[model samples]
Target: MLIPTRVRPSELDRLIAAVDPDLRAPLRGRVDLGGTPLSRATLAAARNSIITPRPLPAPPIAARRIAGVPGAPPVSLYVINQGEPGTRRPAILHIHGGGYVLMRADDTFPQLQTIARAHDCVIVTVDYRLAPETRFPGARDDNEAALRWLHREADSLGVDRSRIAVMGESAGGGHAAMLALAARDRGEVSLVAQILVYPMLDDRTGSRRMPRTGIGEIGWTSAQNRFGWGALLGVAAGSSVVPSGAVPARVPDLAGLPPTFIAVGSIDLFVDEDIDYAHRLIDAGVSTDLMVLDGAYHGFDGAVPDAPVTRRFVASRDAALRRAFTPGGWRRG
Candidate 1:
């Protein structure tokens, strides 16, 4: 975390004014999430209070402990199936966000229930280990194990293995991206699509490259971003020799990845990095859809679920998942 816990006065001079009308109330006069650098000192409180999101009612959620990666502990999973039993359908391996340092999987069951019912699809939300205590490959391995378990049990779970997708928000988005990449490089599991909502992609974002003005002044800030990255990697953020297959943004080749749908707020710190990642995906001949909401900030969809921009983001995500799960497969741009 940087000195001067709150955002600099210069950054806030225009950042607050640029936020969406509906999204301004939460940011108005607020010190951008307590104005504290996320450290072990503040991590506990942030985990308990920072993830206050409004989600829908959930169906009966079945808890299961599945086998983990070799030599690792078992992974926890929440399997939700809204479709008829024995009816094969599309599935989404949903990963929850907490900047790779906070939050849990089951805390988001309410929202997962909505998606499962709406799509009549099987959903498997993973409980990947968080950072600081568990770093880098720990969470990634948990997700990979869950993905493998899903693919392995597709028949018994009434899921169509060919139509599975990976999705997450914020840090969860980073995990989803990493899972997609590992799935590709390992050739063990094939993903139909990747839906990343305002994902934290690059460590260099707030470290090497200064955050753009008007963004990161609210919600998740550069200071938090730096801490989050360092916690995950167990090293300085934007360090040169990170472990292989850790950071999605640092992966050299983007070709052969599944179709990707990315959504980011206009004033979210990740807007530029997400857009650039989308561009690179397109350049790699992959089908990529990017939705940038105007006057929105990080996590605005959850903050103001009923806002117009939020609705648009939700619609785009659903539509992208639908297309990817189609029988014929996703259509290229």
Candidate 2:
């Protein structure tokens, strides 16, 4: 597939320059995953190379372990509180995106701290179990466990139970979407909103024969997507039998879900699925806000933080979050 000639020249330049040379070479045309497969070791090495010691927040965020449901493993939750000690603040349950296979809870602390300070809310980043070793529902269970723990200990943690929201990027976003559905079905918890940042929502997305989006050319390729989903599902990607909870796009209904905020680049691999999900949410009578960045690709905001497109993306996301956290701002569906 040829690179979309429709991409703005300036954005295309940034995309090419930001991607690694090796990746840039393959991105000019269709990528061959079979020739260069993504392995667990390779992914781990890449993650380690980028991992750095993040400085503590000014007031310091508390890090602690909380027990998951009776038999589940204990999960790590990073609590960022910028409000007064006793004041109940709106909370955001943040899930980090590593295709559901890589990255730790602390990898998201920098952004969590920023959001916590910006919104003056309690931010909790959950270190959910990763895949291959732990399959479907294992990671989801850990996230749900953290949510239950937060609500149960709300008073003590100074979190406003009524205003809690779930937010995440990529696989994390997928998890947030599933978590919202599960929470609704179980009738155990209520959410003010769900912020899905270019969520990886569909398994079939990996098999779709689509033109190369410059963004997917380098980072997060279809082959990688296949590996990630396969590891998480314990089955091949695009398998005939897969659980709706594991793949949000498969869910038959989008009703009863909280107001949703979805942002994706026009050229992202998940673009179609994200847009379709947004339309479905609106059709289901859910208040949905969708932002499609022109001439952008997957993880564009993080990949080029200072780019004009990225700045706009960050601003839009922060605005959506602020509105959701505001008292009585979210209209229950």
Deviation from native of the Cα of residue 237 in model 1, angstroms: 0.6
Model 2 worst lDDT run, 10 consecutive residues: 1-10
Pairs that collide, model 1: none
TM-score versus the correct structure, for each prediction: 0.93, 0.87
lDDT for 65 in candidate 1 is 99
Q: Pick by lDDT: which candidate is best? A: 1
lDDT of 2 at 173: 95
Q: How many residue pairs clash in each candidate at the backbone level?
A: 0, 0
Task: Report every candidate's CA lDDT.
Answer: 0.84, 0.78
Candidate 2 Cα errors over 4 Å, as ranges: 1-36, 82-85, 208-215
Provide the RMSD of all predictions against the true structure, rounded to 1 decimal: 2.8, 5.3
